[model samples]
Target: MITAVSELVKYYSSFVDAELLKAYLAGSRSEERDPMEHIEAGVQWICQAQDAFECGGVARSYSMIYQPYFRKSGWFAPYPETTGYIIPTLIDYARLVNSQELVDRALRMADWECRVQMPSGAVQGGMIDQASSPAIFNTGQVIFGWIRAFHETGEPAYLASAIKAGKFLVSQQDEDGAWRKSLSDFTMNSRMSSYTYNTRTAWGLMELARVTGDEEFEEAAIRNVEFALGQQLENGWFRSNCLNDPSQPLLHTIAYCIRGIMEIGALMKNQEYIARARRAADSVLARLRQDGSLAGRFNERWEPAVSWRCLTGEAQMAGIWGRLYQITGQPDYLKGLRRTNAALRKVQFLRTDQPGLYGGISGSEPIHGMYGRFEILNWAVKFFLDAQMLELSLMKKSDIRLQSNGLGDVASAN
Candidate 1:
């Protein structure tokens, strides 16, 4: 079967002849949004982030790219984790939207990261007037993007870039088995405050280690994880945010923690991480209903507060369920996954008006559409092409692996 990346390549090259292109060229409504427009929209935000180098390393977060931007009641520029997580989405979008131009632009951003890395083994999420800074959360997501760029192209340049980010993360670990300002700084330092930050970053670390077999990467992942575990609440659930900040216990942030920890758990063979993930999954599942939906954010008391579009939460929860099923071979997880996917399908992210091969729907409904299932667009493409890729793994048997990541297929010359 053909891989998702191949489909993406076809998507990218078709843009010139795409109806959207004609519309844009003709100044008509017949023009759909360019996939690169989407990618560029994303990348443009990256340029505004803590590390805006203009290299096109748009490790975009919806926060970065949202035009006519208005801040959330409690949100700010560049969601920390998405900055890293958007790497693959942008790269794939770049590839499918014209691989050479977009991917090279993405590579330029990745290149900037390699050059400006801090000695503290810390990386910046976005640029602060072109200054050096770092955060475990931002570093993780950025590393993830850089690594995915490498994976898509197999270019030494991308790989080298990823290694640089990975090495910085590895060096940032603290002695108390956490990667924070200090071991005692768990109060507001925990990533639990930010949905998907910990998980994406952790997942990124594992990705780098898995591909490169770098012991340091692995060790840093382990240590950073142990630190996160230390921050877990008594009943399960990661704690993040300032003690003064009344808003806490976000479902989106928790999902990131869950995915990163669970993926790392399986990869590291850490039963504890696995068990913890299961418990969190169970916690989430318990809260989930027969209708396949979840509340947005919660408090320490498990009280639902102001709920909004939690697209990332739903999508990652599906991914987490898929991972759980893969690791334990549990049908329950699959059922849970069906629920998540069902809910996800109802969301409006599938702007199926395929104006271009690689163009994606602008998600607005059940999903706010950034960094969550957006990443899964590739997974879905691959899954659609190869149904077997969706099968769960059995702990007693082999791991579930999708052969094609939907990022690098070539199109036939027209």
Candidate 2:
């Protein structure tokens, strides 16, 4: 009991700055603001994270408070797994905003990834400083960057890298479509055998299949997705899905699973896959509070398992909801998208003097929540920007559809 109190005191004492204290006390709930402003701030934070790392790849996170145990703070080393997927977001944002600098920066990130890739064609797990070892999930994620880079520049090098990574993924995959080997060291011990969330990795393989016209990649992706679907309960909660605890899975992994299924469904034009994804998405949507916040974790029964909010998962779900709106023209999904995005915008610190806190989404709301615990995560910002961009694009499309249907004034009001 004494140790717990001491730890709490230490945690609070780390917030030495008055500004940080003020921001913390302000909490994550606030009035709706412009998403584009938040998007811009998110992009700026990402750039700073990259610059701080001094490598083309973005840093893993920015510590907002001091950690007495680790005696560490500030920007962390570049993470290959997230950095791989972040490439596509950077490229999409650059094109949307017409920024050549960001485009070049993303290409450099891809090059850095290529430099550090293992001879086995698999990307290393954890940060760059970690011992070099092949990781199945990491390799699958980096394939995303190479695929996008190749499409953007018609670069043979990017294509070659993607093919190699895809081959590695295919080789590691089990006949049942599960990946039982070369899992990320960061995953919990209980989940080492297989992860349902690797459906996201399967999505990466599917993307490669689309680019290379390789039936092998497509078949492997299908097997993995099928394996993941088998883990989904009738209520849409997935078993053996969480990185830490399967009994109570983090919403971040939940969103990842749904997104993989959704994307693959769309790519393959399979309505069954889309419907299955919607089942899970809808279950999650039902858990949204009236204030638009959701619990960071949920149990197998789809009950809230924590008080804090996983901001990363919220942003991801917003994008998923937005996509569902586009696919089905569902009003509830549209409403959920707007509500969640607005909630996210409110929490974004647009006026902060601290560059680390400015524009970067915290891994969890309240900052000190267990998910990321006082860190602004790179992937959090990446997913936030992606969601905001999707919101903007979809709203514009919705407006056009409404206008063409003779609801011009209604569209104008929105």
* TM-score per candidate: 0.61, 0.91
**Model 2 worst lDDT run, 10 consecutive residues:** 405-414
lDDT tens digits by residue: candidate 1, 240-343: 62223335555656776777787787667889988987877877777776767666665665565545535445556666676666567677877777665555
After aligning candidate 1 to the native by TM-score, how far in Å is the CA of 1 from where it should be?
Answer: 64
Q: What is the lDDT of candidate 2?
A: 0.83
Count of clashes in candidate 2: 0
lDDT of 1: 0.50
Q: Output the number of the TM-score-best candidate.
A: 2
Q: By TM-score, how accurate is candidate 1?
A: 0.61
Which segments of model 2 are wrong by more than 4 Å? Answer: 1-13, 27-31, 68-71, 399-414
